[model samples]
Target: MSERREGALDEATIEARLKAELPAWRYEDGWIRRTYKTAGWKSTLMVINTVGHLAEAAWHHPDLTASYAWVEVRLMNHAAKGITDKDFALAAKIEEVVGWQPGAEGGPLEGTPTDPRFAYVKYDR
Candidate 1:
């Protein structure tokens, strides 16, 4: 029998949280998932590495599915055998780091150029 975490969220709670907190993420089949589309292989690798680093730092790992132009991140508390606060927290951090756009914010750090030749990520419009 799988052990559930103390703070395991029910389906309704998960759905509500996903909608309110992580609009791009969805809960399905016992996991919260998000797919980030990149420019190509290089960007895909970058995305994977970034997620890896964040997961390591947070000590909460996620399952990643990658292709030449996209990466799908799925998060679930394996030990708990259910979606928990840890999963939601990690997912929120990943979403923040992965989707950051300095250029659009007019920050000092210019994000990747808009030119296709130098573009890395396909930011959601």
Candidate 2:
């Protein structure tokens, strides 16, 4: 079998990277995690699906926990036995996709719904 080679980052480096790049994610128990507060169940599902797609594309899956109004994404390199660049890369992508807020001065007006019904609200911003 071909061996998969991956190098895990030390705790100090991981902490610095998390602070600078992924401010919302927390380092705990050998994993970096971030919880996204959604508008409701529908929004929750959207977040889950988005995460799934991103994870699949990156081939670096994260541990996801969902509730009626929130989803928590935790990333770690199990094969490497610690946090690695892969985890951070996926985490950044997840933050970008999930935290995207459309609608600018000249940007497309078709952004996330402001209406309570369809909007994927974020409690922590």
The whole-model lDDT of each prediction reads 0.90, 0.87
lDDT of the structure predicted as candidate 2: 0.87
Report residue 54 deviation for candidate 1 (angstroms): 0.3
Candidate 1 residue lDDT tens string, 1-125: 23336767788888899999999999889999999999999999999999999999999999999999999999998877889999999999998899999888886999998889887878885
Query: TM-score per candidate, in order?
Result: 0.93, 0.89
lDDT of 2 by residue, 4-50 (tens): 33688878888899999999998998899999999889999999999
Query: Which pairs of residues collide in model 1?
Result: none
Off by over 4 Å in 2: 1-6, 104-106
RMSD of 2: 4.3
Q: Which segments of candidate 1 are over 4 A away from where they belong?
A: 1-5
**Could you give the C-alpha RMSD of every candidate to the true structure, in order shown?**
2.2, 4.3
| Per-structure clash totals for the candidates | 0, 0
